[model samples]
Target: MSNTGLMIFDGEVLRSIDISLPELQHNITGAQLLEISESKVSKSLSGLTLPPNLKNAAVSQVSDGDDVTFRRTEFNQQQASEKLGVFISAVADTLRDAPVVVSVLDGSMLKMFLEDEDDFAMLAENLFTDLDEEDKGKLCKREIRNALVHMGVDMGVPPLSEFPILDDIIKKHDADGDEELGQAQFAQLLQPVLQEIADVLHEKPVTIVQNVEIFTGSRLRKILADEKTLKCLVTKTILELSNEKDSQGRADPIKTLILSNGKELGLPPLSSENEPVALLYETIFSQLNNRDKQTAADASTEDGLMDSLKDILRKFEDLLETAPVYSATNI
Candidate 1:
């Protein structure tokens, strides 16, 4: 009888297999293997077919003796942007007319009525009557927890003597540091995240200007022609923004937004010196401010685009050291 033992090697080591050669005889003929050399086994077996299920399945190769390998899917920017947009819209709509107190400590845990319109109205009315004169429109830690409990929201944590988490939540959202949360303070806590989400959702194409005086005009053309000078100016603008700090000593969000928008608009790896980074900043700032003006007239709009833009501009204007100033002469 012909020697029936068939060994399979994955890079010099034999791989374990429970199936016998008789099972694969129809797909891989003994005559075929006898004709091929040991070095040619891998190439010859490439055309061999296994069971239909196994043939269609994806098989991964392991070279470093690892039993398994993971394949990660590429990040899809467009899909992520769309999902963030939907989430932002949903949150904005939920809080538009509701007495919501979003936790600043854990911003993801928003406190809003999940009931129907009529139920919410009744709950608000009942809650209002229970409120003391001093706490009429404000929610303290105890009151917030009670309200949550009434709304059937489970805290999910083991009962503690004082629920220290509530204190942290109050401290973060309490703008005046009074251990309570008001509508205005709640909105403030929510604004930054909402603004970022809006920015991602409403990403417009970068307006590339060719005939602009600042970029293509006589004086700018000379400065921009030197690649080194252009790169220096762009780097300087970013550094200026990076050095700016807010009241909390954190990097200013408006400047951060401007820089982020600039990157998305392809400002860093500038295709041409004719596309001035300064113009990109100016364009983003103008578009944001103009959008605010247009949306401000509507008081009932849920997107809060106008409010978000105003907040960003207020921070931008308050920056003691502004972006590098550029002057343009007519063509």
Candidate 2:
């Protein structure tokens, strides 16, 4: 087993950083070394030079009883960067929201959709619409099995004689236990498969910061705890940054308008210099109620900030996706 520790700042540990021997060897940059060295020797500290090996070295100390051994080893920066990129990609992929599929009917609808057959379409068009309310409430086991068969055949899954899984699926959705699956039950049975397909078709990868709900909620919680930071972030976003233009000469009018309106409504101004734009938005979101938060988030999506965020996220995703395939030898 290897011992690991975090690189801490201001007494708070940043999450997901690994400072194990291997990691430290891989991530030690020239800038980091310069920073450490400069911080140590108060005045100028110019004319100092580092060993060539130090550029690729990992610094660590191991203690045994009263004895301590310091170790240093060389590692390639290209290799390290690739590994870090891969790690980031994995984390980004995990943060993505699962895809959503519209449910047509029970799990049977999934089979019909996958097969793209006329029979399934006919059944879908007539089944519930033709049946009376009472009749539409339940579908017999035979009907479910037929739908399952249609689904299984297309997917190369053989139908079992007992169809135990089918029975369980129906039972799970058969809320009334009338030995039949109602429309709602049918929809429930198909949800998982439909959702999987939906995810594949309409997948949108997002990081934790890009996830509106988590980003907003977490920032709000933090701001609420620290009123000073909250005020600073709010003032910067609404009063200053909103009017600032990007390289393309476009302003964030939606954010500007929203923040200005918020201030007009007697909302307090929070002041801070050089705060990050993301943090500013997070503070703004934190002040909103759930409904308002959602509304503001939705509005941001339409006003181009969402696209910018997505573009940034995609760049990271692309870097991570390609990292594993990158070769240090090529560099």
Candidate 3:
């Protein structure tokens, strides 16, 4: 503290940083200003020396979610560390009355907290503000928004004072949902991901065995590759799930169950489960609503045929009531 002496107000560095002759008396706890001149102090202020460990401290405290991507490159990580060190050093060097503090943190904890979403999102929002206007668009906005949403917006993006736009965006997106979730929209969201997963399976052939609703391994791969149909179904499932009476109450769990059940409820199981029964109900109801369409096309042929199919579906439903898992062959 003595290297560059200054008179501070009430021991706060920022309150009064005067480089004139020392003004208070009876303070022997710290360094004495002695006879230092204003010119010498001004020269030292221009120099702005910081503690050597400043960068290390800043690097240690760096949050993981700002897309810093420490694993991306040694150079990038080290550079960030150094730049942060400079900032910390600058603060430490200037603020004589500041109390220095640091905490020991685990890499695992750092990684987990970073991914906790809501917490990271708040951090990203701050990071967003710190970035240049152009830089804000690329890394900050998307990641922060995603993190904010993924956390379920429980408190509605804490530090709400920051992102005024998020509330409106969420409301708008919710309000604008299609009457039913669109298959095309669903396909677009997952198609690329499924394709990537499928590419890995080409090397080792495997079956796309359906497990309830989960598509394990090779099936998952296949679904990713040729998922135009499944994606559409998934989208519709989501839409219906949204419309479900319980939708607003427990969204995540309900959505998860809806998707899991839908993924397994293919053409084979439709005859048994309410999923198919429900679809049939809709189809039958629509047909009943449009007597002209029923009579116009193939009422003499298709109408009775549809009745027989409905009876067959009823029998399948009876069989399905007793089992946890059922297959088409068993039905």
Candidate 4:
């Protein structure tokens, strides 16, 4: 049996694991999870029955507060599998702006709303698809990729293998019997798991933006040997808060959206009135900047919330370096 992570969008659920025939182990067989589906377990398994000993197939869905009743199992796993990625792409887009509102106990309308949410694309898809014409992004690949990575994690591939600044080095041998990277068997082991997770996450709309570039080390040996080059990377997103208007209950709602690198030295807040949109860009523009000097790439994003959180940590460490914001009354 496999332990899996899943996300739900509307009538569809996005998955992080691939459910395949080979993976239908006895442990996860009976355990089932139901989300916003018109399909009934009885109906779907009518012809394709679960083994009598099946035990732990579970499912979950994210709520947006809509109510509905799923009486019949009308969903076909095969059909659901085909459209999973497309479904997830839609939900991802909707959630980026704001969470989709769901009403409790209104399953019928909720299903209808989910069906209508099909066209909304996810942010992960947006970032990748926008540049899709130029090239593929680490995030924008098929749900198959997502499944493979997750399965790889289960099989114990270090998550660091996916990092832009990292390399997934697979040596020719390990006494532990784990398949080495690039082996035909290793690739094959991932196929089923990949398909399942891809099917699921393709249904959910939540997008976790990880560092993008994923070309492996051997894929970059010549470039790294140094022809003296510069490149740009997103270090961390910076946000500046503002007191626009106080809500009846809440102190003050966010009035701005600022995405910064936090290195402009001294840029003033754009406003205290309305929402703001700002983005900070860090680049490797000169030959000298490419040298082994202190830079954003050397920083750690593997653990921190923001890319340059070290900077924030240092600032907070020194109390003398902080200042108070202007109060609403003062403004």
Using TM-score as the measure, the top candidate is: 2
lDDT of 4 by residue, 1-331 (tens): 1122211122123233232222322322111213222123212222112221110111212111211322122335553443333333333333332122211111222222233433212322332343335443332223323432442323322233232211211111111232232323333333333233333333431222111111112212332232222112122221112222443432111111112421122222333351211111111112223434344333322232232332332332232123211111211
Arrange candidates by TM-score, descending.
2, 4, 1, 3
| Model 2 stretches astray by more than 4 angstroms | 1-16, 21-135, 140-212, 215-331
lDDT of each: 0.32, 0.34, 0.33, 0.26
Query: 49, model 2: CA deviation in Å?
Result: 42
Across 1-331, the per-residue lDDT of candidate 1 in tens digits comes to: 0011112211211122111222222332222322221213223222222222221121211111221321122213343233223322332232222111111111111212212445434554555445535756765534543443343212111112223343344345432233666644443343332233223323421111111211112222233245554344345544554566653564433444345453232123223343444454556557554655445333113233233433443433333124322222242
Compared with the true structure, model 3 gives a TM-score of 0.15
- Provide backbone clash counts, one per model: 0, 7, 3, 43
| Stretches of model 4 off by over 4 angstroms after superposition | 1-182, 209-331
* TM-score of each predicted structure versus truth: 0.16, 0.19, 0.15, 0.17
Colliding pairs, model 3: 55-85, 194-224, 208-219
- Best model number under lDDT: 2
* Model 2 per-residue lDDT tens digits across residues 257-294: 44554333222233343233334445434444333545
Error of 1 at 267 (Å): 76
Output the worst ten-in-a-row residue range by lDDT, candidate 2.
1-10
Candidate 4 C-alpha RMSD relative to the actual structure: 24.2
Task: Please report how far candidate 4 places residue 132 from its true position, in Å.
Answer: 30
